[model samples]
Target: MTFDRRQIVAGLAGLPLAAGSASAQSGWQARFPELVMAVVPAENASGLTGRMEPFCAYLGRELGVKVTLRIANDYAAVIEGHRAGNIHIGFHGPSSYVRARTVTNGGVEPFVTTINSDGSTGYYSVLYTRADNPAASIQDLRGKNLCLVDPNSTSGNNVPRFAMSRMGIANPDQHFARVVYAGSHENAITAVLQGTCDGAFNWWNSEQDSNFSRMVNKGMVKPEDFKIIFKSDLIAGSPYAWLTALPADAKAAILKAFIEAPQKDKAAFERLSDGKDRGFHPVTHKDYETIVELQKFVDQMRRARS
Candidate 1:
């Protein structure tokens, strides 16, 4: 888990600094002396910070500025940070990025999104229950407790609701005996494993790339202890976005660093990607249009509840 800082620095020396020219580095740095990158709490704060620090350090060296990492308390905090112009870059789930765009009025733009190790750019929302729970499907869990990761979580909340609605369970709150927001993906999975909830919705990319897989790798949960009872259609992978207001040169520099990470900063990329992603692919708002529509649907559901 150690990154070769000297190797990374040496490799980055040949890459374009800013706007494809070394001279523009000072111009972009003058505008953004320090860049703050914020992320949602997909895992515990300490673990997330440890995983992100190397990537942040690599980005800082490539950009010639201090790149600070902030593990947001929740998805809303990341969105709010972008809205307030405090977060220069945000790593967000698809639905959270949609919300960030809405709140900022297109102020944030997605520069790159994850590419799965299988070469796909999407993942699934899965409804998981204890393997011995006898619930073969989401329908079998009627009148049972359900755990959602967070309101802004795509796989944990929005896509689950969308999949459930298609299954005729129009109102999850009413359909389930009780519903709870676990606030983060790890927490939601933990609730289900602890029997605090009968089931939880979380993201799964493949057999090797998933929240469950990561936990299993950490020995936090056994793979055989839980089963996915339901799975949603492919949802776009999470994105790394930045403020559109930043200088064009800065945006180019940031995007360049990410696009080159897999080659120039292999260890950081592996740690950040959990060895389950191929690399970052250039992306735009158009790539997330379907998610934008889905978030709007979830927003309407929220308004009705209020």
Candidate 2:
């Protein structure tokens, strides 16, 4: 089937504007053994899929089913996949998961969130400028071009919007000389280095491992080459989400897979998470209430602007 970006966004993220066709029934596990897991494509899709194989294999064993991985090229694709019942499990950003409930009309449930290296179930949404930009603060970046990750991204767009608003910049597009969507964290980081934008919005694990650090390690750039101008209070971590349409037993098994996968298959989980994550801790919609509220605020702001 052809990739459907439009349907995905319709069921994924609002166009700053804003489906419930799910029915959770028993025997879903028996009827559908191929559990389709959708992952947000934060980087190269093919490479990510290959790197995730070992973890998927391990999950398959735990569920006693065949696990098929689908790399949704952006956050919205994963959301739509879930709404269309094409996805069983989703490794979702906090903002995307929060948006899923509204987009799916309550067809999704977040079960657990990754615990980062510092033992927190969250990370930071940060702004970075070139090392020599001479910008000491977000105020300094006003009238400068900026790059943001996907609109559905937590650190990339959602939290940045909220944080920027709180910083007294009610309009990033107007304050920043120009606003560009860099598509992914890596791209946003690269954009700053390549002068695509004056600064960028990205994220960091609690360990301080971020796009900059990752680039530094890859010989792509130096740690001193970028300056952190703004860092939002920790946003809820990425979540292991499930469709409400799944059978109760299936959901239980999936949640168990997340909770135990780290301890039982430490190396695989670490490999899957690129060493930025430790494991998942039990969580509920309430744990992300702040993000829910933030999203509401973002919607209100966008509406007011329109």
Candidate 3:
């Protein structure tokens, strides 16, 4: 995946950068000369590079600095960038956020999350198979090959695995005939449809938007061609987070920009989200404690294998 700074038209007014409170008044400009932002490679780079340029320009104009966008090759690169203090702001899935937060020794804190069309801050991890398959649930997937997204994916891996654990099928390697990482949500669904795997994992908003829906919308797949085998409870959406080491004033401006970007520029916001999301809502580290706990559970299961 090629990560490059995109050239986008500028001069859009960002939502108010500062509030009336005294705390909001700081030399934010002097503190932040150049801002570097990264997004985990959740989709193809070309699409993101085209869609995100306006958002970056909005950030640049509001923060009184130059914003350089970096699309990472994979989740690990984004997490590593955050840990090394190279990325000032990042977009990360819940599972990757937890891992980055832990690996960075709590140096990353979430400030905002995507607000879905249903006004929820979460989505669901789902399993799908060919319509001809007799699988009614994940339990039926035993002895069948499975396609999973990356290990750091939330709905793609963490929540779905947890659901399996609750169903008394905690050990996927032992249950499935074989498990393969399809590298992305779209790929996972495609793998199942193409017969590369009998089952696949993906995620989407509870209100009718997901990887499957995206594919269907693009004419890549049809609704009647697949069956949902399992769906996990609401998993938190990805977040706009910044390294905790960043100065509070700058972080405040970044959060403010994120919170208001959708309302400020609907087209840019919609393009950036790539979903039926309304906007961003405030979130904190405490908000992600559930994900932290989930990661802990996943870790123990992996440790048991070692």
Candidate 4:
């Protein structure tokens, strides 16, 4: 668990300092002058660096502080960076955020999330079947082949499982003729389209930049190619969180920068918000209570199974 100080310092050097700032000011001096934010790759990509460059630049310029983007290969690495205090801020899924908060003992707090075009702060977990599938509802899917995203995914796995459980479908293996883990939302969608699975579960929101739309447009599956049989209640979207150890001034500056970012740099905001359909909005730890509860239930179930 030992990190090289030189390497950490080198990473921080890439961060931009606030305008006219002589020295970095924060309650906890950054191991380096720049703040490092970590994000999980969506489809085995190395990181979000390539996707979020504009957003990172906007943050640096607006906050008068250096902001650096770090990509983790998966969700667990994102959590680990937050726990180790290497990541000053991060964009994390609800379940991963809850786990990170627990590990840090309140050291992290969500500050902002994607705000949909309709001004909604939440999204849905959609259970979809092929266009011509006879299944009209969760109950009707019994004995059919099913595809699910990763075990750790929120809308992809957790919410869908919760929905099925509530509907009295206790075991998918018994209900579905077969069940397959597709690893990613896109994979699940593709499985259903290719006739590999009768149904698939994934997240759907107004945020347009997501790969979901890409797959749809690529003819992997048309909008009309599937039917949504179940949709979960709107759950809080993922947030950009900061470590509690950050200085009050630095934290305030960063929060203000994020809130005003859309106004100051509309293009950048749109890019980070996942396309022109949404922008960032203030969020807090309490916003994800429902997700936390869901994670607790999932964990309990996992332990019981083990």
Residue pairs in clash, model 1? none
Q: Highest TM-score, which number?
A: 1
Model 3 residue 109 CA deviation in Å: 0.3
Provide backbone clash counts, one per model.
0, 1, 0, 4
How accurate locally, in lDDT, is each candidate? 0.85, 0.78, 0.78, 0.73
- What would the per-residue lDDT of candidate 4 be over residues 1-306, giving only the tens digit for each residue? 112334433454444332123475543334335678777544433224545778888888866556777765456666767766777887877877888898889988998887777777777888888879988897898888988876667877788888888888877778889988786677788788888999888777743534466566445557777778877888778788888777777788788888887789888776654454556788888888988899998887777667
> After superposition, which runs of candidate 2 have C-alpha atoms over 4 Å from their true positions?
1-28
lDDT of 4 at 110: 92
Best by lDDT: 1
- List clashing residue pairs in candidate 4: 16-66, 18-64, 18-65, 27-247
Task: Return model 1's CA RMSD, one decimal.
Answer: 7.0
Model 3: residues with Cα > 4 Å off, grouped in runs? 3-26
On residues 206-288, what C-alpha lDDT tens digit does candidate 2 reach at each position? 43566567567667777777888888887887887887877788778888987898888888898765777777898888888
- Selected candidate, larger TM-score, 3 vs 4: 3
